[model samples]
Target: MSPTSDLLAAALAQSGFHPRLPQQRRLYEAAKAAIHQQRLGAGGKLPSSRDLARDLGMARNTVIAAFEQLAAEGYVVSSRGSGTYVADLQAHSASMRGVGATPQGRSTAPAATPSARLSRRGQELTSYAAGPQFEIQPFAPGDPDFSSFPFKLWQRLQNRVWREARNDLLDYGQSGGHLPLRQAITEYLRISRSVKVEVEQVMITAGTQQSLDLCAQLLADVGDTAWIEDPCYWGARRVFQARELKLRPITVDSDGIAIAAADLATKPRLIYVTPSHQYPTGAVMSLARRRELLDVAVRKDAWILEDDYDSEFRYTGRPLAALQGLDHDDRVLYMGTFSKVLYPGIKVGYLVVPPALIPAFRSALYDLQRPGQLTVQATLADFITLGHFTAHVRKIRQTYGARRELLRHMLAQKLPRSVTISREESGLHLVIELPDQVDDMALAQQAAMQGISVKALSTYYLKPPIRRGLLVGYAYCTPEQITDYGRLLGTIIAAEAAA
Candidate 1:
């Protein structure tokens, strides 16, 4: 048999081509697979129909039809007088191929690996760790108490929207999201978080993650400096990095991002801050720091991304207002998510852009991400307007507050005096700062083995970890589990310290 026929036969068997298929289709698919797999080289001559048919025990007509199909699909070329030849796809395939095909018309290179197929940026982006795991094990940070969400009411609202579903609701929704949801969000933000936003400026996103991605793409150019809080949210760091931005990690103090004369000289194009409630550390940005940051943004012509995630559950004094509310220069881009308050699977969040930038942001969000889930957006609008959202927040705040206190009490009572627990006045998780000798990452791993799901605080940092701590969550754990797992975690820490 000819080399082409041998490859075609092998590919047919290896590809699991069904024998029951029509001979023409089977031969066509087998030939195409061999060509795609580069077993058939560019410009290689195909065997005569009669010879291939006889070799494969197929009718000549079947082989002729298969060749014609391949030619029609540009997989093969015919010169009228000369026999058909495999199309020269080398130019188009160069990006996907290593070196080149061998003399036998087969690729000597290994399978196309990620390093070969993905772009430089894509390869670098994939190296970072993914977002939080959702196992909801004891002390898992970033997960709200799912058991307490009013699923029955949510189902009823979703069903109502579906039952009355109009063409607009079912179609590609407005890039700014469902109008009612935007209006609802505007009202809630103005009243609760003290954000200054109009309904027109609101653009719904998949969540804050998508919001970060949109900001990275729209606001800053490649290599532009972005000021990120050191020991920041890993997801935000990844998003900024994905856009190829230069990250300037600003150290965080009791008051949000500590600005230095050097940092002001750096003059970043974008500044990301979680001012209301800092992640892991839970330090609320003081009013003075908020104004100073705003001033810096104005002076540098920069944009501030204020991620107000999980600020609704404040147990202490009045929650500090969002940084966006303080921005007189319209340099702040406020981001909020229902994921932490409701559930992660809900996948609804909003970005409040400056009024003038709304059109560009809306168009970019639609063009790039095409935010949808209109039905869910509609349901969330109802949840907020009908007072369910307020009641739910109030109830969970009380519940999470009790849980937070119980866990704090347990840790204080059981752990060594050297182990300091900060008063995490707001948010779902708290950091347990350990002595410098303790390896927080190793402690987290040990806790994971015992079905605890805390995060090592050091991993969140952009610089070498200066602090050793474990981030333990309370919102997802029931009161009983807090007492039980809290003791277990304390015991583990004590043992590690003793060692």
Candidate 2:
């Protein structure tokens, strides 16, 4: 197959293209993924729009819509007699990449890899390539047990939604999202996370990554700096860096996201933090630090993107109220996801911005993503309203809590002297800090080869302290599986230590 067709096939398989998805969306996703990952290169000529649409079995208008969107986003350009081509992003936008390409029929030598043909920004993104891996093996961070999800109930809800599905429900929804789902989210946040927001302030997103991208795009400009906790969620870092924003990796302490004396001197346009339960390390940002961040945001006139990631699964004394709750001023942008609480396939996440910012947020989001599928949103709202969402969280919390304890016990018994267990108060994952001499990445690879999906603490660090360790997730595995994996991991560590 041609490279363009190959990319569509990849997207179809990777995204599990459902007939329910709009044809325009499928094309857009495939093209974006292809371009961003450099599977499609710069200056390459596109097949005639009509021919391509026919090949994909999509209506011609659907393909036109996709191309128009891509062009608007600076991904492609059309000429009067030369035909359509990928935008030479570098030639037009300095900070943008993946747009400009070598024209077809040109005699210039080809770049070695897709990455080489990309813009500087695009090449940087490939450096942190997190290839897809969803193995349910021991210690895989963020891999939840989907088998335990109430798929039957979900199917029934989906069935009910489709039976009553209205044509308008499938079209571009209110840029802010389906109203009922937003209301449900508002109510849930009020009681559960102490987050206060009206339905108008909450915007539905595809995932946390999309939310981050929106925050980066709308709040900050290219080359503007943003502060993220060092050893942070790699996904967030990727989004910010891809936008050509200068990322300042602030160090994290036991208190969480400690702003250093040096860091204070640098002006930031945006600040991204996981204040509820910090990723990888699992450290909860102290109330005092939360206040400090809020004050800093207010004083600096910077936007704070609080990724309340995995806060729902907190296995602690009533989960801490979200950092957004403490912000008196409108500087904080609160992000929450249904992926962790419910399941990733739900593809529903929401953002709460300040009231004054809602109109702009809605407009920008609609232009950027044109996101909808509200019939699914309605089903989610019904599920939340009927209490299944809460009940499932309660049940999963208890189950994951037990698994956490089991993993903790096993690690202490198996590798007590060799590793340090830090931050066990919240979230689905824990850190077992290893010796400085051990190479975490190599060890993790060995574990994976032995059928364990593990993450190295070193991989998360963009700045110093840069400790070596393993991140073991307990939410998905059974107690027995934890023990078995713990022993296997310990064995690997012991050998690494010896080496």
Candidate 3:
């Protein structure tokens, strides 16, 4: 569709437009929508009132009145003999200056000028998009069924927090986070993950990625070396890279993060591991490796950042206790988020560190960002304290467990026996290893064309010997959808394999 009419239809689709409305108001909304979407650019001529009415099936008089109202509001100008035209947006106000950005976030404004060049690091960061967009195509990894969250309960909790708000809540919160939320988290972690910590050690932040950023800022220097699991969560690795840390990708096996003698020789400044459940690969770190890692950190005087994301969604045997729970030297900083458990919108995550790091972390937090989202933190504290959070986690864990099984069953029935499947005890996704001859990148692109969004396993590697596979997430879709998706994936893989 042409941009103008297309945007108009989209805007109208989002509206509760009523014919009973005063004619002027209806026209005003239509004109404003068109302008806001930049479907009608500055000085772009709009259809005549009669033509607009006929096209939209509205009253001609109503369109005329709306046009008059828009003119009065400086949205459009009605020429003496010509049709109405959108006002010069840049001339109107700051709000109207860039209504024509394309879907990719590229500005559609012809008059817009380029800004100054970005810094070297900014340019480097933008050279390639580093992480998943979480686009909800079939088999996309790491996303949960966000729609299943109990919004009514959340709404009630939010109302309670706001209703009880005193004057102190109006100011910026303490940089470390809300104390009550920290206390709640401290209690929860001690019971659930077996991490022993006082409330003072819990530093609430936005989420896992922010937690990683904080670790980079507070613990390590720009050129310091960080040893991450080879096929690590790309998002966290990118955070460390953004802080200009040199990354060393250590191999991961069944025991998780294979720290070799050579790795010890590196004397890494920081070590990042997903010990509860290694990301993408789903390898749970063994107790032996966990102990070895803790010992290495103590010997090397290195900091360990434990990412416990998705550890709450285990469907198999009881999850292994967090690596931080095993640390005796106070070297590991444990970070966990409510994003996977409750929902991503909460933006609430906490860091449990050594008592000595608390002051530095709290100070660095304010330096990086001003204290914000106090109300959200407060509501989440109530949700956790009242046991709603645990209840929700239990319910969704069962649902995801069933979905995971359905996925496995379907893949087994439909796919070739040569497809090597690796299933682990927990996490949202599984690794499906493809044959060496099959180009994983090409397969991923082709699968995307067929409405799947799984990532090629080769893309996760930063060292020699890339692993050829696909990471398929089974947590979000229904069992029926999983079966259908499996059928489609099997067909796609069959065709790709033959070629």
Candidate 4:
């Protein structure tokens, strides 16, 4: 078939014709849209009725009837012995435009550029640096090993969900998510992370990004103070900025956020922290610091947004108990995502809110995002109850630990001792600190050219006084790739330093 015929065939097959509409009418509408959109250009010859009918799995008569209608409507022209050609509508289109009328003769308003149409808030939100394009390369940060996932088992569970599907499974789920899934998450968090929560306080989100968006919207108002950890997760930062929250970057030290006495004068409405394993820089918040922050939150009447992302992959000592567990005032909004532990495509995360705010958060989530994925949630619940979730976590922790060691070893052997590698005991990536004079951004670009994916640590900071380093991820890369790429990256870093 010709390209035009193939395009039309795809259009016809996927146009989602209404059940009540006859096939001929559907075909006529689809064809008219193609012509009006100029996809079928002027004088473009259409396929023969017989060819079109075979391609679309319709009767030849149906195709002929549709074609006749289109020609009658001046969308096409049929010749004596030649194929039908798309009619030239340039003159008609120009005439309509001149009179400020659309092809359907509706009076149209003046067209405005996208920037002009957007609100001031929209422009500010768009101006922030959206993270990388998520390319899968040597050391792209926070990416899990997709090949290691048990797809067959996951498929079997999903198949079972559909096989025994109920009306509730197909319909819109509760704003708080599938009850069983929420219960499962509650149990898991209580045992694994020491997150004290009931199923009623749990709300399912698409991911941490959605959870952040919801919290920013519901917990705080526009222009209200939001304290975010310096050099924080860009995703959370973006969410707060989008909600027009006034962000105060709190400096992070050896123990998570170093809250100074002066810094607490202007009380914040919300406090965002990754106390488990800080992003880019993997500083586990000390127990003392956790208690201090909790006390501060209570004193200031602030809500602490504890993002326990990647807490399951701790490789040394033990995974620290979540900061939420220490909250006596129930002011902490604990968030966790399956993206880091499972795969990113799962698109499932949970936020454990305070009991009092449950109704507000649930209603707001439903009204704003309309969260639904009951089938996936059901299968995930089954996977957890069957002990597959913990098993998977154990299996990947060993694999990632090995990869992390190999990459560290390779880089240590190749790079100079002057380059200081962070000794954080957990998380997917490691930060290699550089001298103040070395340009980490330029080094990152040069490493990318060599096919080594690493993020510049300087870029993570919200304000200046930034530390210079590169975040090299080991969770996604295999031993062989890590060894090879680590050597190349080491050489690149050494050269950059010498220059």
lDDT of each: 0.85, 0.81, 0.80, 0.86
lDDT of 1 by residue, 46-150 (tens): 999989998888999999999988876667766555677776554434524555443344543223332345677887877775755555698878889999999
User: By the TM-score metric, which is better: model 1 or model 2?
Assistant: 1
Which stretches of model 1 miss by more than 4 angstroms? 1-100, 105-115, 131-134
What is the full ranking by TM-score, best candidate first? Answer: 1, 4, 2, 3
Candidate with more favorable, higher TM-score: 2 or 4: 4
Candidate 1, pairs of clashing residues: none
Model 3 earns a TM-score of 0.76
For residues 1-499, write the lDDT of model 4, one tens digit per residue.
7787687777767746453589899888888888878899876788999898888888999999999988776677676466677766654444335543333333432233234445678877777756558568889888899989999999999999999967788766756899989999999999989989989999999999999999999889989999999989989988898898999999998788999876888789999999988876888889999999999999999999999989999887778889988888999999999998899889999999999999999998888887888899999999999999999999999999998889889888877767888898789999998988899999999999988889999999988846899999889887889989999999998887777
Give the Å shift of residue 98 in candidate 3.
27
CA error at residue 459 for candidate 4, angstroms = 0.0
Give lDDT tens digits, candidate 2, residues 213-270. Answer: 9999998999999999988898898898889889999988778899978998999999
* Clashes by residue pair, model 2: 42-101, 43-101, 87-99, 87-100, 88-99, 88-100, 89-99, 89-100
Candidate 4: Cα lDDT at 52:
86
Top TM-score hit:
1
What is the C-alpha lDDT profile of model 3 across 1-499, one tens digit per residue?
Answer: 3355445555555657655666557657866867766767877777776667766667888778877777766666666665566765454223246554322333432332111134568767877655546468778987788877999999999998899966666666765888889999899889878997999999988998899998998888989999999888888878988999999999988789998878777978899999888876778888888999999899899999999998888777776688888888899999999888877777888888899998888888877767678888888888889989889989999999888888887777766766767778677887888888888888989888888888998888888645688889878887777999888887787666666
